[model samples]
Target: MKKILSLFLGVSLLCSSCNDVLDVEDISNYNPELVWNDANLANAYMANLYPMFGNWNTGADAFSQQLAGINFYADRITITNGEFKLWNYGRIRLINQAIVDVNKGRLPDAVKANITAQALFMRAYTYFEMVRYHGGVPYITVPQDRYEDDLAVPRNSTAECFDLIIKDVDQAIAGLPKKIATTSADFGKIDANFALAFKAKVLLWKASPQFNPSRPFNNAYWAQAYEANKKAYDDLKAQGYGLVDDYSNVALVERGKESVFTVINSYPNKVANWDNGVRPGSESRGPASAVPTWEFIKEYPMKDGKMFNDPSGKYYKSEEALLQSFWKDRDPRFAKSIVWNGKVYEVSGKAGKRQYTALGVAHELDDFGVNPKAGVNSTNLDRYTGFFILKNSLLKLAQAEVQQYDVDFVVMRFAEVMLNYAEAANETGKMAEALDILKQIRKRAGIEPGADGNYGITANTTAAMRETILAERNVELAFEGHRFWDLRRLRMLDRLDGTTKHGVEAIAVQANGQDMPIGEAREKANRYELVESDFRYSLLQVPRSGVKVNVVPGKYYFFPIQRDILDRNKNLEQNKDWGGSFDPTLP
Candidate 1:
């Protein structure tokens, strides 16, 4: 800002001989009125607004889906930690100011329409995030003057909030461009089809048990979700958007095909931090966060679409027996998403090296009482959940280049919309359509379709199919930030109560009480793996500050507004769950 001011003053000094000083305008300052007067300036203003949406790491791994996390899952989330607070009226004010200025601007009709649509979409997205956390917030459409305007505004009803969100999204759909191709310059920007998909997700939340707990199985709500999701699916399907064949490439490489909405990223610019955060420290030279829990590891079905506990499945056995060959013959996605004992993994600049996680290995150690200087989980004891995440790791990058990973953060994808449609359709008595969608998803995941081509899915009733859809979502959207919010919106956090999440510690033991030549794991893969005689396994109960499992409260569905926020606005009523009269569940 100082540089811009100096340049402006310099230009004024140069033009003093030709013009009057009183007529020169200070353009570098905050000028909302001047922004909408030109098309390119309006675009630059829109660019400034995109950073508020954040990245793909918010809900990626948490207690609702994975075993634990550093913040949201390490312990119970109380009302005051600000974990549940997303008070975004500041963002709403900016967006509303843009909307008002764009409508009043004298720019080209096309430019005005495009900018207005983008602003409306962002506003709707912000409101949806707030509603999901704290139900209805004050629906402020126009910017409130700091000193002149009356600032005491009450919260809107949940129904009124939804109506306003729908209106904004409808305008966005009407004015935004169609789906832009990967080759287009505007590929990552939100398009008409992506707006439609966002609307579908918003309606899905509206129909969920979080909002409709009293009328838990309302067909009207489900119908709304079904219709919107179907429209999005159809519109995007016609625009050449669908699932990419390889699961790893969907979020990493195929930007325009599977990704319905993407937060644009590139190297040396705004780069994605997902790979650096999840990959092992030994491999990526970053923290080994987001390691999978034992329970989460069991969540993946076998290659035949059967749980490992299914008696009829090929590898079904006792717990110890199952852990013996845990890394073998599972779903193709298992190897893609997780790195276990003695498994070959892709690392840049290395020639086919298998990862060893058992104790006594040179690097990988989550074992008790042993320390190594450069192992994967050696330094951070909390990160050693006995398994490391391998979902979106770059297949070819040297350790030094890990910081340069530039995969776009996929906020919404076609596969998620398909899941939304399936859930809504099944709830609204369109069972056949729902099952078909699920089958298509499983097919893309490389699950074996049985002789009848049903993909080993035997959920013949609505209740059963609903469970199946939820389970599929657990794996399909694993590290993409959908798990906790999914369970919250569905009112299924009770699933975590009374449940214990365990970890595994793999120790390298000497067979027959003598050292064996278990050299490289890949060469000795058949004999010296986790299930062999050279290793000992232990079930670990990892706790943070002596707290074992998650004990989420029921009122957590609608969190309380912070005391500071309530103190500022005298008209604001607090949520009843947090000791006030505003019941977030009331429709």
Candidate 2:
């Protein structure tokens, strides 16, 4: 299948003489009938839709850091009136055109069903993106053959847009196969499982606080979301979907059973640079981009299922103690997801040895030996936080380089489905079901159950369980590009306001005369110690000093539609609080 798709990519869209013939009074343009007639061509066209999946590593992940309180604000991120607009109609046009062609094509019912299902899925997916960003956009299903009334369709209501998304997904689910066989030619194709999972996610968003905010919380919406999530969870589980036993290798292992939907990339064709960009400065080929902030790092729970910062717990009194115990015996996911100070990582081409040095610390030659200076000035190219993301960093090789390996980027996995179910279930008063799911996830993470066989979650009340589920999601899905959207949908961005991002500061202390050529008898002496460890936590200044950053719920929840789009379409309305007049030019 890959080889066939590659062949299509290499071919020209039209013959060399076709353009010349058209210039000689042949004004009629060519239709994409060949693409619809051939299954391979249709499949190739569908492949183009895969790239539409978000590249979180490069784009939104960085922007999301502020909202998630995961990183110190390096620069103030301005919220503009044109943050994201429904300006790009190219994908929509192609999807609509494909749907039209697929319905009219002379293919077998089975073949046509799969192709049409995929086209509808893409269309729904695109519209979902638009609605999430800008509340209501014009729901145009049919391809615009000519300009006239079709070109100036008015904007639909937010509920109308969501209804259309659900409708399209339902059609896709009915037509798509339950499962794609491993031996089939189209192994990684979208199936009913993907559609169902997506439908649940959309419904969950619709029920979230940002979208369905009423004076009194709407329990009915939550119930609806709960039912949808439950159906998706049960159906996906029956189809053999479950979490990977080892969370560390989730990204390393491609298209495993845990993955329900993922963007598969292969070497030479498409490759992810996450490993190169997220590895620590000392180990990475280039400057690391996604540094894990102290705010995020401190969120991981202890091995005993207690918050690391709990006042009644065994909290680290000093900075030295914090760094010493921070990575030691904490949540298993912590070590699997982050590389902190003193965490030794394997390097290729030599016998790997455990080593520790604060990021950007300089090594200096001394009488005792080469000593690492903890207070040495470092560049931003070095990690701003003392930690780096370890989940996507494939550093087990002899020498890990940028863009060398093709790691599949997960979009939706079984673990996320479980988390969604747990949240919705709890909201709808299904406490026992939610707790069971939470216990399963916690057990997989190596968290021990309490005396009562619970995962130390004594909170059976809805409010407490809600808090528990949110925290679990935070740790379980950290750095997977879910934090920002999660915060936004919950209308909880204010939680990050007035918070300071932090990192660890430490100096390496070496034993006296350690660098000297010691006799065999003296070789057993202590070598070094990390001393005077301190937490470097500080409030970030935005738009100059003394201005605390805050996300206004009314204005900032939904992004504004671009000015040019409003100009082009007379019926379109700009989002409120954006300070724009909707003076549309009538045709």
Best by TM-score: 1
TM-score of 2: 0.84
List model 2 lDDT by residue over 1-587, tens digit each.
45544744522363344332112133124346666677766766677556777543732444344222333232232333444445546678777777887768777778888888988998898998888776778888986755344576777778888889999999999999887765566666788898998999988887787776552135467787899999999999998899888988666787788888777677778777777667555555665666665567667877766676555444323434555557765778888887654455554432433323332332211011111333233444223455567776666543445567577778888999999998888888899999999999999998757567776576768889988988888888887767767877777766654454445443332445232222221222122223222212222222222333443343456777776666777777776656644221111
lDDT, model 1? 0.73
TM-score of 1: 0.89
At residue 369, give the lDDT of candidate 2: 12
lDDT of each: 0.73, 0.64
lDDT of residue 445 for candidate 2: 91
- Lowest-scoring 10 consecutive residues by lDDT in candidate 2? 362-371
Which 10-residue window of candidate 1 scores lowest in summed lDDT?
Answer: 18-27
| Shift in Å, residue 444, candidate 2 | 0.4
With a 3 Å backbone cut-off (N, CA, C), the pairs that clash in candidate 2 are 348-398, 368-515
